[model samples]
Target: MLSDKERDQVRQTIEQQIAEAEKEMVVLKELTAAVAPDNSIGRISRMDAINNKSVNDAAYRNTRTRLKRLQNVLEKVDDKDYGLCMRCGKPIAFGRILILPEKRVCVSCSK
Candidate 1:
Protein backbone atom coordinates (compact mmCIF):
# COMPACT_ATOMS: atom_id res chain seq x y z
CA MET A 1 0.00 0.00 0.00
CA LEU A 2 1.18 3.47 -0.73
CA SER A 3 1.30 6.35 1.70
CA ASP A 4 -1.04 9.28 1.33
CA LYS A 5 1.63 11.44 -0.26
CA GLU A 6 2.51 8.76 -2.77
CA ARG A 7 -1.12 8.26 -3.64
CA ASP A 8 -1.52 11.97 -4.23
CA GLN A 9 1.51 11.96 -6.48
CA VAL A 10 0.11 9.06 -8.44
CA ARG A 11 -3.19 10.83 -8.83
CA GLN A 12 -1.47 13.93 -10.14
CA THR A 13 0.55 11.89 -12.63
CA ILE A 14 -2.53 10.06 -13.88
CA GLU A 15 -4.42 13.33 -14.24
CA GLN A 16 -1.64 14.76 -16.35
CA GLN A 17 -1.67 11.67 -18.54
CA ILE A 18 -5.43 11.97 -18.94
CA ALA A 19 -5.07 15.57 -20.10
CA GLU A 20 -2.42 14.57 -22.63
CA ALA A 21 -4.47 11.67 -23.95
CA GLU A 22 -7.46 13.98 -24.40
CA LYS A 23 -5.32 16.36 -26.39
CA GLU A 24 -3.99 13.56 -28.58
CA MET A 25 -7.48 12.29 -29.20
CA VAL A 26 -8.57 15.74 -30.35
CA VAL A 27 -5.65 15.98 -32.78
CA LEU A 28 -6.33 12.47 -34.12
CA LYS A 29 -9.98 13.40 -34.68
CA GLU A 30 -8.91 16.42 -36.72
CA LEU A 31 -6.44 14.36 -38.73
CA THR A 32 -9.01 11.73 -39.58
CA ALA A 33 -11.57 14.36 -40.52
CA ALA A 34 -9.13 16.09 -42.85
CA VAL A 35 -8.56 12.80 -44.72
CA ALA A 36 -12.22 12.33 -45.57
CA PRO A 37 -12.88 10.77 -48.99
CA ASP A 38 -12.86 13.28 -51.84
CA ASN A 39 -12.67 13.12 -55.66
CA SER A 40 -10.45 16.22 -55.88
CA ILE A 41 -7.21 14.28 -55.25
CA GLY A 42 -5.41 11.78 -57.56
CA ARG A 43 -5.71 8.03 -57.00
CA ILE A 44 -2.30 7.77 -55.35
CA SER A 45 -2.94 10.74 -53.10
CA ARG A 46 -6.30 9.31 -52.13
CA MET A 47 -4.61 6.00 -51.33
CA ASP A 48 -2.11 7.83 -49.13
CA ALA A 49 -4.93 9.67 -47.38
CA ILE A 50 -6.69 6.37 -46.80
CA ASN A 51 -3.53 4.95 -45.29
CA ASN A 52 -3.03 7.97 -43.06
CA LYS A 53 -6.65 7.84 -41.93
CA SER A 54 -6.30 4.18 -41.01
CA VAL A 55 -3.21 4.86 -38.95
CA ASN A 56 -4.81 7.86 -37.27
CA ASP A 57 -7.95 5.83 -36.53
CA ALA A 58 -5.90 3.16 -34.79
CA ALA A 59 -4.03 5.78 -32.80
CA TYR A 60 -7.28 7.44 -31.79
CA ARG A 61 -8.68 4.14 -30.55
CA ASN A 62 -5.52 3.44 -28.59
CA THR A 63 -5.55 6.88 -27.02
CA ARG A 64 -9.16 6.50 -25.98
CA THR A 65 -8.44 3.12 -24.43
CA ARG A 66 -5.48 4.55 -22.57
CA LEU A 67 -7.57 7.43 -21.30
CA LYS A 68 -10.26 5.08 -20.02
CA ARG A 69 -7.73 2.88 -18.24
CA LEU A 70 -6.11 5.88 -16.64
CA GLN A 71 -9.46 7.19 -15.52
CA ASN A 72 -10.28 3.84 -13.96
CA VAL A 73 -6.98 3.85 -12.10
CA LEU A 74 -7.67 7.36 -10.88
CA GLU A 75 -10.99 6.23 -9.48
CA LYS A 76 -9.29 3.44 -7.54
CA VAL A 77 -6.37 5.40 -6.22
CA ASP A 78 -7.92 5.80 -2.81
CA ASP A 79 -9.04 2.20 -2.49
CA LYS A 80 -7.40 0.00 0.12
CA ASP A 81 -6.34 -2.50 -2.52
CA TYR A 82 -5.46 0.02 -5.16
CA GLY A 83 -1.87 -1.14 -5.54
CA LEU A 84 -2.38 -4.76 -4.62
CA CYS A 85 -1.74 -7.44 -7.20
CA MET A 86 -5.07 -8.98 -8.12
CA ARG A 87 -3.48 -12.37 -8.90
CA CYS A 88 -1.13 -12.76 -5.93
CA GLY A 89 -2.73 -10.51 -3.30
CA LYS A 90 0.63 -8.81 -2.82
CA PRO A 91 1.56 -5.17 -2.74
CA ILE A 92 2.69 -3.95 -6.13
CA ALA A 93 6.01 -2.19 -6.05
CA PHE A 94 5.95 1.60 -6.13
CA GLY A 95 8.40 1.66 -9.02
CA ARG A 96 6.09 -0.46 -11.13
CA ILE A 97 3.14 1.81 -10.38
CA LEU A 98 5.24 4.83 -11.17
CA ILE A 99 6.01 3.48 -14.63
CA LEU A 100 2.64 1.79 -15.29
CA PRO A 101 -0.15 3.41 -13.34
CA GLU A 102 -2.80 1.20 -14.92
CA LYS A 103 -1.12 -2.03 -13.78
CA ARG A 104 -3.23 -4.24 -11.53
CA VAL A 105 -0.86 -7.18 -11.15
CA CYS A 106 2.69 -7.37 -9.94
CA VAL A 107 5.61 -8.59 -12.09
CA SER A 108 5.74 -11.99 -10.42
CA CYS A 109 2.05 -12.64 -10.93
CA SER A 110 2.08 -11.19 -14.43
CA LYS A 111 4.65 -13.77 -15.54
Candidate 2:
Protein backbone atom coordinates (compact mmCIF):
# COMPACT_ATOMS: atom_id res chain seq x y z
CA MET A 1 0.00 0.00 0.00
CA LEU A 2 1.21 3.48 -0.83
CA SER A 3 1.74 6.01 1.88
CA ASP A 4 -0.45 9.12 2.02
CA LYS A 5 2.24 11.19 0.33
CA GLU A 6 2.56 8.71 -2.52
CA ARG A 7 -1.18 8.56 -3.07
CA ASP A 8 -1.38 12.36 -3.19
CA GLN A 9 1.40 12.48 -5.75
CA VAL A 10 -0.40 9.94 -7.90
CA ARG A 11 -3.62 11.93 -7.67
CA GLN A 12 -1.87 15.05 -8.92
CA THR A 13 -0.41 13.09 -11.79
CA ILE A 14 -3.84 11.75 -12.67
CA GLU A 15 -5.35 15.25 -12.80
CA GLN A 16 -2.56 16.55 -15.04
CA GLN A 17 -2.88 13.63 -17.43
CA ILE A 18 -6.65 13.98 -17.64
CA ALA A 19 -6.42 17.67 -18.54
CA GLU A 20 -3.87 17.06 -21.26
CA ALA A 21 -5.89 14.19 -22.73
CA GLU A 22 -9.03 16.34 -22.88
CA LYS A 23 -7.20 19.00 -24.88
CA GLU A 24 -5.81 16.39 -27.25
CA MET A 25 -9.27 14.97 -27.87
CA VAL A 26 -10.65 18.44 -28.57
CA VAL A 27 -7.96 19.07 -31.17
CA LEU A 28 -8.83 15.77 -32.84
CA LYS A 29 -12.49 16.75 -32.96
CA GLU A 30 -11.55 20.00 -34.67
CA LEU A 31 -9.42 18.22 -37.24
CA THR A 32 -12.20 15.76 -38.01
CA ALA A 33 -14.65 18.58 -38.64
CA ALA A 34 -12.18 20.83 -40.39
CA VAL A 35 -13.48 23.24 -43.00
CA ALA A 36 -13.32 22.20 -46.64
CA PRO A 37 -9.74 21.69 -47.78
CA ASP A 38 -8.07 25.10 -47.89
CA ASN A 39 -6.79 25.43 -51.41
CA SER A 40 -6.99 27.57 -54.56
CA ILE A 41 -10.11 25.84 -55.83
CA GLY A 42 -13.02 24.37 -53.86
CA ARG A 43 -13.25 20.60 -54.16
CA ILE A 44 -14.94 19.57 -57.45
CA SER A 45 -15.17 15.80 -57.50
CA ARG A 46 -17.40 13.66 -55.25
CA MET A 47 -14.39 11.33 -55.05
CA ASP A 48 -12.33 14.18 -53.57
CA ALA A 49 -14.92 14.72 -50.90
CA ILE A 50 -14.97 11.01 -50.15
CA ASN A 51 -11.20 10.91 -49.85
CA ASN A 52 -11.15 13.86 -47.50
CA LYS A 53 -13.93 12.26 -45.47
CA SER A 54 -11.91 9.09 -45.15
CA VAL A 55 -8.91 11.02 -43.95
CA ASN A 56 -11.03 12.81 -41.39
CA ASP A 57 -12.52 9.53 -40.23
CA ALA A 58 -9.09 8.01 -39.77
CA ALA A 59 -7.91 10.98 -37.73
CA TYR A 60 -11.01 10.84 -35.57
CA ARG A 61 -10.62 7.12 -34.94
CA ASN A 62 -6.99 7.43 -33.90
CA THR A 63 -7.77 10.32 -31.58
CA ARG A 64 -10.71 8.48 -30.06
CA THR A 65 -8.47 5.53 -29.28
CA ARG A 66 -5.99 7.75 -27.49
CA LEU A 67 -8.68 9.59 -25.55
CA LYS A 68 -10.34 6.33 -24.54
CA ARG A 69 -7.08 4.98 -23.20
CA LEU A 70 -6.60 8.14 -21.15
CA GLN A 71 -10.13 7.91 -19.80
CA ASN A 72 -9.61 4.29 -18.80
CA VAL A 73 -6.43 5.20 -17.01
CA LEU A 74 -8.25 7.93 -15.09
CA GLU A 75 -10.92 5.43 -14.10
CA LYS A 76 -8.29 3.07 -12.81
CA VAL A 77 -6.85 5.86 -10.69
CA ASP A 78 -10.23 6.46 -9.13
CA ASP A 79 -10.45 2.81 -8.19
CA LYS A 80 -7.25 3.21 -6.15
CA ASP A 81 -5.81 0.63 -8.50
CA TYR A 82 -3.86 3.05 -10.65
CA GLY A 83 -0.43 1.50 -10.12
CA LEU A 84 -1.55 -2.10 -9.68
CA CYS A 85 -0.85 -4.60 -12.42
CA MET A 86 -4.17 -5.91 -13.67
CA ARG A 87 -2.84 -9.43 -14.33
CA CYS A 88 -0.52 -10.13 -11.39
CA GLY A 89 -2.07 -7.76 -8.85
CA LYS A 90 1.38 -6.36 -8.10
CA PRO A 91 2.13 -2.68 -7.86
CA ILE A 92 3.56 -1.36 -11.10
CA ALA A 93 6.97 0.30 -10.88
CA PHE A 94 7.12 4.02 -10.13
CA GLY A 95 9.20 4.64 -13.23
CA ARG A 96 6.51 3.23 -15.49
CA ILE A 97 3.89 5.33 -13.74
CA LEU A 98 6.03 8.41 -14.33
CA ILE A 99 6.26 7.54 -18.01
CA LEU A 100 2.56 6.74 -18.39
CA PRO A 101 0.60 8.06 -15.49
CA GLU A 102 -2.52 6.44 -16.87
CA LYS A 103 -1.17 2.99 -17.70
CA ARG A 104 -3.36 0.18 -16.40
CA VAL A 105 -1.05 -2.82 -16.63
CA CYS A 106 2.62 -3.17 -15.80
CA VAL A 107 5.21 -4.01 -18.48
CA SER A 108 5.02 -7.73 -17.86
CA CYS A 109 1.22 -7.78 -17.94
CA SER A 110 1.20 -5.57 -21.01
CA LYS A 111 3.36 -8.09 -22.84
Q: Highest lDDT, which number?
A: 1
lDDT of 1 by residue, 15-91 (tens): 99899999999899999886656788978999998999999999999999999999999999999998899898899
What are the candidates' C-alpha RMSDs? 1.6, 4.0
Per-model TM against the reference: 0.89, 0.64
lDDT at 99 for candidate 2? 65
lDDT of each: 0.91, 0.70
Instruction: Give the C-alpha miss distance for residue 45 in model 2, angstroms.
Output: 13
Which ranges in model 2 have alpha carbons more than 4 Å from their true place?
34-39, 42-59, 72-81
What lDDT tens digits, residue by residue, belong to model 2 across residues 41-107? 5556545766776787787686667667766765655566657887888998987876676666789
